[model samples]
Target: MTSPVPPADPHRLPVTFRPTRTRAVLIGIGVALVVVLTVMSLLLESFTTGDRVTFITTGLLGLGVLALLSRPKVVATEDGVTVTNLTTVRRLAWAQIVRVNLRSGDSWVHLDLSDGTSLPAMGIQTGIDRQRAIADARALRALVDAHGTVHSAD
Candidate 1:
């Protein structure tokens, strides 16, 4: 059973973009790996101090990777777009945006800035689900067109 999606605000742009499958798979794998590692570490009967440290560090690393995978997103609102990539989160006003690009060969949607800096919209990933990615990119372009004075690349 699926719950109905809430209606979007007419005056505001859509909320956010997300990768369909890749993120779920990655998050599942990350959580599973961390759990397995932790269980094995705890079950071990003997452990040196160094071994304990290494085991804990490995689990923490898995959690860190999970955080990274789950964090990236492109959020749009009446004010602007917020892009959260692997290591950075940037908020840009509509006027600062130059274009949104999701070319056929590109891995993800890219936001072109007026400053000439291009930022990847990791939330709208391609290759994993091509059609969905295309549709999302188009929707994002529509938002940009409606709220901002910018042209997107083909």
Candidate 2:
């Protein structure tokens, strides 16, 4: 059985939701990979200067990609929500969000907008930790309910 989600305090103007485990894993792996590659490049006596530089550069590029993968987060304030995905950052007013959904089998939470479009909220991902993702989704839903304005269809 699922427990009731506690009401979010309106006084808390800003709240951030992010995937902790995923971010930690990505960063840990990325850093370790970079360090290993760098050390190997330095130790390899057969590799020329150009080869060593290329190896280090490759490692840095891999780290950059991992960093991007771990960049998703959602910041909610009294005024609006700011969602940062892999490459895009979008700010949306409460009214702009018609609904927040995290259906079964969904990888992440999706926000239904008043414009009839859905925005993926990667910060509340279910892949790494399902329970935490569900909680975060519920919290986001509560925030939307409290702050979002209803738009009547014409």
Candidate 3:
């Protein structure tokens, strides 16, 4: 058995969203395939029908692999925040983000926008420092306070 390891100090903020239902389903199917593989091994099979199972397991595993590879990366600079998704990147001015807080479960950064809208910043992950995360959020709040106006993103 191995022990758990804590996350190292992250120099760059990379936000991740809650795994989508589609992704979770893929993982669940992969796990189920493991069970099926066990059953097939015990049965008297000739050519092995396990090929179908193997292909399914591989496909599901591929989904998980794609999810990880396709996750977005978020970077904060003095001027603005950048959200880099798989196909495109969008930059939001600091003024557009009224506040940024690690969500209750520390899953993602929740952005309270100037338009009374909230957005999940899927590019950053929640880390151990809850207090630090809150403090970081406050700093973002200050930035918006200085420059943000209603309908800024509009």
Better by lDDT, candidate 3 or 2: 2
Poorest 10 consecutive residues of model 3 by lDDT?
Answer: 1-10
Q: Any runs in candidate 3 off by more than 4 Å, and if so which?
A: 1-57, 60-70, 84-90, 127-154
Q: Which order, best to worst by lDDT?
A: 2, 1, 3
Error of 3 at 86 (Å): 8.2
Q: Let me know the TM-score candidate 2 reaches against the reference structure.
A: 0.90
Weakest lDDT window of 10 consecutive positions for candidate 1: 1-10
Candidate 3 local lDDT, 1-154, one digit each (tens): 2233233222333322222443455466656766565565556465356665675566657656666634555556656677665556778877787666665675556677667887765554444334434444444444445545522221
For each candidate in turn, the TM-score is: 0.82, 0.90, 0.43
Per-residue lDDT over 1-154 for candidate 1, one digit per residue giving the tens place of the 0 to 100 score: 2332333343565578887477887788787877887777777879766776788789779878876877777889989989988888899998788888988799999889999998888888875677777777877777887788888777
Predicted model with the maximum TM-score? 2
Per-candidate RMSD, Å = 3.6, 3.7, 8.1
- Give the better candidate number (1 or 2) by TM-score: 2
Error of 3 at 51 (Å): 3.4
Best by lDDT: 2
lDDT of 2 by residue, 1-154 (tens): 4453454564576988898889999999999989999999999999999999999999899999999999999999988999999999999999999888888999998988989999999988997778888878877877787788743211
